[model samples]
Target: MIVETDGYIDLIQYLTENLPVLSEQQGSKAGTSSYTLRECFEEQLSVQIMSVCQQNDLDQTMRIDIVREADAILYDFEEVLASVLDNHPTLEQEEFVTEFIGLIKNLFDARVKA
Candidate 1:
């Protein structure tokens, strides 16, 4: 769970660093993020993370065998947002929206909080 949490934090950090315009456009701000949940499963399941990132990246210098693994996680994130909501009765629209907004705020904040 900790790694999953850290991965979400890292992904949000990466996004904030790389895609400020998109993040702002999305209108999400952050708490109780499901962002890295998929990454945790990918790490526990197989070695697909590195290839996914490499394939998606525009960098020509990207490594073929990198340690970064979060593609599956990203996929899972989409699933949670899109499909899982329909299946899980306990998940509420407001709760997800709140958490998503919190995550965005966390990214925008200059001082990272504990």
Candidate 2:
């Protein structure tokens, strides 16, 4: 639930296999779309981290450390995803971002339960 490296790899695989392709009718500039996706991810991650910390009754210091670690992991995962998407130009960015956010949320929920 803490999403170690293996869990991150699983997330990447899940996104690759399950993400839906956007229809051609939904047109948007790639840069704007990417920025929107990034913003959504940041916001969702913040909320999820806070929820997890609160549910688990973590102290302030522990919450900060866990958030910091999660952020770092997410940043690294984003970089890896960017590289993969760069190589596979046909994939829809929006779907990937959406799936990634969902995976992160699920991971946080599991961590809280743990």
Candidate 3:
């Protein structure tokens, strides 16, 4: 199932709007345990993606298709990061990419579970 461009746009918007909350959650969860930037980013991303999937009532298959479609449009990870940052300057690039990776992974995981 090919996901529409509009769908990807909506997903991006959802992610952007929720970033601050996600980042705060990550910080709170870590407590005094220090994590590398990568680790922190990944955890936050995963949580946010899962939340979005649940909220949207997106089944495993639909989540997978959406990730695949978004990936196809961006071509590669670097490009995906660049595209997201370019579109959302207010967001820290590293954080945005980390969440993007989490979104992609969770979407694929949904497919695997199905």
Candidate 4:
């Protein structure tokens, strides 16, 4: 469930689309509201990660576990996405969507099964 990019927009969308139930369970509306989740994940995760990236001025480099909580969040989303995709085979996979879809598939294949 590594968020393979800079700004984390894709990662935020992935989380919101997948883990709506997390908000109910958490009872903080953290994961339910896409806007709130984006603000939080960005303020909490993206900001720190971007700071490092900006300081280094690196176009792209591997960032592992920038936010300790992200691992759990990603796992939750991966589960949700995998279940949805598994149930909905008619879902289209296109270039614009494949970045997130492919990552979710990889997450399911690698992390969920393992």
In candidate 1, position 77 carries an lDDT of 45
- Regions of model 2 farther than 4 Å from truth: 16-35, 83-99
**Deviation in Å, model 4, residue 89 alpha carbon:** 32
TM, every model: 0.23, 0.57, 0.33, 0.24
Name the TM-score of candidate 4: 0.24
Per-residue CA lDDT of model 1 for 1-114, tens digit only, reads 222466566755554443322222222332244544333333432433333333354344333222232343345445444423222122233343445444433432312222
Any residue pairs clashing in model 1, and if so which?
29-101, 29-102, 29-104, 29-105, 30-101, 30-102, 30-103, 31-103, 38-73, 39-73
On TM-score, the candidate that comes out on top is 2
lDDT accuracy of residue 10 in candidate 1: 77
Q: Is candidate 2 or candidate 4 better by TM-score?
A: 2
Relative to the unseen true structure, what is the C-alpha lDDT of residue 89 in candidate 4, on a scale of 0 to 100? 19
Candidate 2, run of 10 with poorest lDDT: 82-91
C-alpha RMSD between model 3 and the true structure: 9.3
Candidates, ranked, lDDT? 2, 3, 4, 1
Tell me which of candidates 2 and 4 scores higher on lDDT.
2
Query: Candidate 4, which segments miss by more than 4 Å at Cα?
Result: 1-21, 25-35, 54-114
Best of the two (1, 3) by TM-score: 3
Indicate which candidate wins on lDDT: 2
True-structure RMSD for candidate 2 = 5.2
Clashing pairs in 2: none
Task: Order the candidate numbers by TM-score, best to worst.
Answer: 2, 3, 4, 1
